[model samples]
Target: MRELRILRPIAKLEDAAVLDPVVREVHRVVDAVLKPRALEDLLHGVPAGHPMHPALVLVPAGSWIGAAVLDVVPGASRASRTLIGVGVLAAAPAIAAGWADWARSRRQQQRVGVVHAAANESAWVLYTASWLARRAGHDGFGKVLALAGFGLVGFGGYLGGHLGYRQAVGANHADAVVQRFPTGWHELGVLDDLPEEAPVRIEVAGEPLFVLRRGSRVDVLADVSTHLGEPLSDGRIDDPGHRGATITSSLGSVFEVATGEVVHGPATAPAVRFETRINGELIEVRLPRS
Candidate 1:
């Protein structure tokens, strides 16, 4: 089946050269400003186990939408203005969370994301203006501005939905590995060839894997980052011991080497881990039983 007509141009935005300059600058700025590991993890929702932007967005979205409803009702001017003010205030953190998530996404997703952010920022500006106008007793003008802002919000929301559902921007990339991989033990390679305390890339069972050996124990995980599919083998291995070892992806996601638990974000999903054993000189791996 063919894709929707509107999606053709939107999809083309992935390769749009016009956005490269802006995307680069925004990326630099965001990375510089959100340099603190703790802050970035919080924004990416590491503690929450998923992206936080979507949930944070509901506050401002609901407030602005509720304001729109109140605007049309008689004797509701004060309530509508209050709601608009509330939306303006609530939009700050939501925008921050969205930016944090966007900063770490792939170029294609970032292309759409930049436009999404622009639209939302424009809407926010309008809402802020509307609130100020209402405070200044310009009720009719405030209503007009609020309506325009709401329109931009709808457009921005559509782009956000496209980024998530269609483009798989914030989805867990490694969630399906176990489902498709064959069950039971599969031979990986000779145990002696597997370097000690170092990550190695191996292709087996139709998937790329990150293999790390420490003495008798071996830790295996899908080689793809759960955030954006950056090669986990290219990432830095920290505390390369059997216990408390972690791998930090190039894009700044940290995962526990043994259990595949996400230690940081922009990655909320754990890597696909494998159970390992040694058959003499040979190494074997299988998906761990749930």
Candidate 2:
């Protein structure tokens, strides 16, 4: 466990070494080239509960595979090569959308994502070369390029698996509840003891909870930031309204805490709720639970 914990940071560094520069350049180009409308359209399916990348994988893979088949066959038509080229071109936008969504993630996730992007980009380059070789009537060179492109795709796919499964890039890191407290209302202390509009760090059954007192009503939330598991008590609270409040992380990811509504991505689910006893009454409030 100790070694594994240490390895996590090292792994992050390893990923960052390769992904950081690559992603920064990619993001710059993408931000400049893609219009707001097109970018919105690209990200629409992602927040709507569907992964855009998998939908994208189909086009390039299908085209490349088809091209490979045609390359081996005797007298494959010019129309078939053109169709494959078109498929490869169409796949670029889907790839861009997937990368854009991935770029906004935590540093560790971004690291793994960078390698994934590198792999895919290499595949794209190879395929583009293959298309060009075919166009120039260098069938032998084109076949070799197509095969290399396929190899790149396979390598990139492995990296994508690492990013998704090992790094948990697109996965919900917030869903894993590590702190399970006992059921029923727990005593958090006297109501007047808590300072107004200030985050009071309190431990409940060994789990940390950030309690915010607003007059007689106490608003409690998990002291941990769901994004990187940073202490939420360490975060800054801004614009505390009757309806909602925003907890801005040290890294600037804003978690909107309404009375009962959760609005944000990365931390898709609501922070856990804990019932606390204050002033001889059981008050219900939301707090992060393990």
Candidate 3:
């Protein structure tokens, strides 16, 4: 069964070093074309706090599946053709969102995504031809094309699932790790450990956090960037904003360490803020939810 799985090539393709530049150039084009933050977010699913491609894909997948059902019915040929046309239309937006996300994913993920997209696009072309053939009264040829297209789409979907679930392209990176911090305050050793206006990574109850101290006032936020779960402590602290000094994540999302509000961000979610109180010699912290 392992040998029979055609979709296994997607995993193998991740190790194909030859295609790296092709993938990089494609991502560069996507980033260059989708320059506006809002436009990029719309395709990336930032508003939904998850990747948007999966949601958009449902339209094409659904329309095709519905058309397949109609294809076998005696009086449903016209309806099937119509549904196929709808699927073709839906594929446009789905592919757009997918390309947008592919730009933001890790290199390895983008490698696998390239083949996955090719397979889907091949299926889309086949399906489009099949629809046109059916409309032109080439019923026998249309059936064969439909079957081929369906097989391609199914294999492509299997690869897409691998990309999403196995490679972890769009997973929420911070939620589980940051939620483990204990309620109420505990000592973080000496207050001197935190440097002024620098984001320092500290482990609190096994949960990683960023500590930024400005004079006597100390601020802490979850160390993970809400955008891609990159380490926020590895980011830089900029000049003061209205709420507090701004910390820029590795992905260029900006957050205020004091209040955890987004000053300018690729992430819609605010950095999780921790309330800090200096108790004499020890620095104490507590989860805001607690």
Highest lDDT: which candidate?
A: 1
lDDT of 2 at 140: 76
Q: Which residue pairs collide in model 2, if any? A: 177-290, 178-290, 179-290, 222-288, 223-232
- What digit string (tens of lDDT, one per residue) describes model 1 on residues 4-50? 89767876777888998999999999999899989999988989988
**Consecutive 10-residue window with the lowest summed lDDT within model 3:** 1-10
lDDT of 2 by residue, 1-290 (tens): 35456435535544456666766786677556544643543452424544466666778777777777776778884754775687679778767766655655666666666666777888788778877887888867877877887887877776677666766654534444443655555677777677877777888666787777777767776666554556667777887645477776663335665432234433333454454445464444333341
| Candidate 1 whole-model C-alpha lDDT, 0 to 1 | 0.91
Task: Mark the 10 consecutive residues where model 1 has the least summed lDDT.
Answer: 6-15
Tens-digit lDDT string for candidate 3 (22-131): 99888788888889877877777766756678889999899898988887899888888888889989999899888877877777888889888989999899889988
Best by TM-score: 1
User: Alpha-carbon error at 215 in model 1, in Å?
Assistant: 1.1
How many steric clashes does model 2 contain?
5
TM-score for all predictions? 0.93, 0.69, 0.86
Cα TM-score of candidate 3: 0.86
* lDDT, residue 101, model 1: 94
User: Against the unseen true structure, what C-alpha lDDT does each candidate score?
Assistant: 0.91, 0.63, 0.79
Better of 2 and 3 by TM-score: 3
